[model samples]
Target: MKALRKIAAQAGVALEEVPEPSAPQGTDVIVEVEAAGICGSDLHVDDWTPGYEFMVPLLPLTLGHEFAGRIVAVGPDVEHVKVGDRVTVMPSAPCNACPACRAGDSEKCQNKQTLGLRRDGGFAPRVTARASGCLPLPDAVDYELAALTEPLGVGATAVRVGGVGQGDRVVVLGPGTIGQALAIFARLSGATDVAVVGFDDAPRLETCRALGFDQVYDLKEPGAMDRLKSDFGGCDVVFEATGKAVSITDGLALLRMEGVFVMAGIHEEDARFPATDFVRRRLQIRASHGARGPEWRRVLAAMAKEPEIFRKMITHRLPLDEAVRGFGLAHERGASKVMILPGQG
Candidate 1:
């Protein structure tokens, strides 16, 4: 079987003819992957970005974290899920011996190994995942939409952290998949108005518009920022999902005094912002990363309830043989969410 892998401590991923995975081990399940999404973090790994040095020792690992599939085999200890179950696997696993895991807070596990990053993951037709990380899918959601749970979970966490509420106006500082997810959840959280912003991102910005966000902007356009300010100034909450430090200044400028600003993106460098103004405004800054177990269930339920709405996030699809091309499309920002169908030719 061929799998997409980061074979070295440098740029680019390779498709290698690797042997099929052995049978499942303790508490693990072997899933026949149906759909996998190419994420920004995957691009980071492919480009050999600065923050991913921890993966240096874990090179040659298969590179996909956001995926959903059916379990072909299950370990002896697995009970909650069984073979033939369609599920989306959470990429992160915690060592149960950690204090946080012992307290039922696995999200804070002192020793955590992410499946796609630290271990082999679902970039191929089959991959092994811990049974605990797998969530059974609802009848309404299929494999492609189910694959979106990870990124959507990320957006859901950002909105919850920002505390978006009824009648609140919210601004999202990126038009990528996560940013789109933030906008969707903000509306679901009862925010009456939501604005999404992008920089020379017509494709993704158009995707935002397609997702029902009317106030979409491309900063490259003349007077676009002015128009955004006129329309959404003094907003109640702002979400920075661009991963660019400079967006902090722009997002804060639109926020009302004491309004919440949530940082949901993974930055590659340090961010510098105005100190005096932030102090005077009494603004609050919050950080949102991966979602917890309950948050995952919530995101999955939302997708199940309105699967078509979430399905729009997927704009491109490719077979496993062409998975590298999918990576390129994602890196160039030419596609919103590219699905890699390992089972498709």
Candidate 2:
């Protein structure tokens, strides 16, 4: 099979011929990947960003976690799903015996192996995953959209953690894939004013505007923050999705007193924020990582209800062989959601 493999610890990936994966013993399932997404994290991995050193030990990894496919084979112990089922796998597989997993907080499991990062991922035509991680896709969701469930789950989890509810005002910094997902899910969670901020030239911002966001602000514009405050008073919840140090400070400034601030982006470097301001405002800070717990089901249900709107986030699709080009588009902010059709040449 042809897979996009990271043959080195550098800034690129190569499409190489490799052995097709099979369902090994112990509840594993082999999936024929239909579509996979190029995520921001993948860009960081390709760039060998600081703090991503853990990936160095897992070098030559197949880089893809946001993917959906059809099951072609399943191990003997697999019961929840069967061959021929269309599904999306949760990339993080928690060790059931860990204290966090035992406490039902698998997201914080002490031992978790993430697919596509710690193991072979869907950047290939076929990949093996633990059957327990696979979630059945509804008929309303197709392969391309199901591939997005993982990132959308991140957004859903952030909203849940931030306690966003009916009539709440929300601001999402960064209009990338995860940022756009946050805005959409915030609206579905009953937020009346959901605004997204990004650079004026970012292509993803155009998608945010087309999706009918209540407000889309370019941070570069004069008095953008003042205009945002004038229109919405202050945000009830501010989600920092840019992963940049500057965005962290700006997001905190936009929050209303006692508002919740959700850090949903992965920052490779250290970031600083005002501790005095946090205390003065009595603001709550919550960090949202990979999707886990009930977010998978919630996001899937939300996507099922608004498939077309969710689908609009997909702006580019490429063959598996064009994986490098796809990553370039994503890294350059030229594409909102770039899908790699692994089965295609």
Candidate 3:
């Protein structure tokens, strides 16, 4: 089987022939990956960025985390899921020996192993996944939309963290897939005004507009910041989804007094903001990482209900062989939500 793998600690991923997964072991199941999405983190890893150095020991691993497919085989202990079931796998796996896991609160597992990051994951025709992390997908949710469940769950979780409600004004910094997800869920959460901003991100900003976000801004354009300030200044909530350190201060500027600011991106550098301004405004900063069980359910239900809306996020599709090219496109911000169909070839 050919797989996209991070072969070393240095930059770049390679398309290499690797052995197919063996028979299921313990609670694992064999998933024939139909669709997988290239994420920003994948770009970071491909670029050998700073934050993902933890993956150094896990080099030469298959690279893909957000994916959906049908189960081909299952271990004897896998009772909840079975063969031929369509499902999406949650990439984060908890070590059973961890204290949090022993207490049955796996969500707080201090030593969690992420698929595609800490171990081999779905970027091939088939991959092995734990049955516990598999969520059954509704028949209406096709493989393409199902592949989006993870990132969508991430966005839904951020919206929940921000406590966005009816009539609230929301600003999302960065018009990438995660930023798009933030904008979508904010509207779903009943926020009347939602703005998505991007810096030199024309393609993605246009994507935000196509998704029905009228208030889209390109910080590179003249007076774009002034216009954004006029429309969304002192907004009820502001979300930093750019992963850029400067977005913290930029997003804080749009927040109202006592408004919540959610950090939904994985930053590679420390962010410094004005302490006096933040304190005087009574601002609150909250961090939202991967989604929990509740967010997964909400995102899955939403995707099933309106597959087309979510489908719009996918701008490019490629087979496993062209995955490197797909990564390039995503890295250049020329595409949003590139879906890698491993089964296509």
Maximum-lDDT candidate: 1
- Give the poorly placed runs of model 2, Cα more than 4 Å off: 96-106
Instruction: Tell me the deviation in Å of residue 339 in model 3.
Output: 0.7
Over 81-154, each residue of candidate 1 has an lDDT whose tens digit, in order, gives 99999999999998778899999987799778887899998899999999999999999999999899999999
In lDDT terms, how accurate is model 2? 0.87
TM-score of each: 0.97, 0.95, 0.98
Q: Which residue pairs in candidate 1 have backbone atoms (N, alpha carbon, C) closer than 3 angstroms, thus clashing?
A: none
Worst 10 residues of 3 by lDDT: 51-60
Instruction: Report, for every candidate in turn, its global Cα lDDT versus the true structure.
Output: 0.93, 0.87, 0.92
Tens-digit lDDT track of model 2 for 1-345: 788877787777888888877546779999999999998888888787776677777878888999999999999888899999999988888878889999998778877888988899999999999998999999999999999999999998888888899999999989998999899889888999898898664577889987778588887888987887777555799999988888888888888899888998888678898999989999888999888747888878877888898888999999998898898888777689999998777
- For model 3, the stretches where C-alpha displacement exceeds 4 angstroms are none
Ranking by TM-score: 3, 1, 2
Question: How much is the lDDT of residue 83 in candidate 2?
Answer: 94
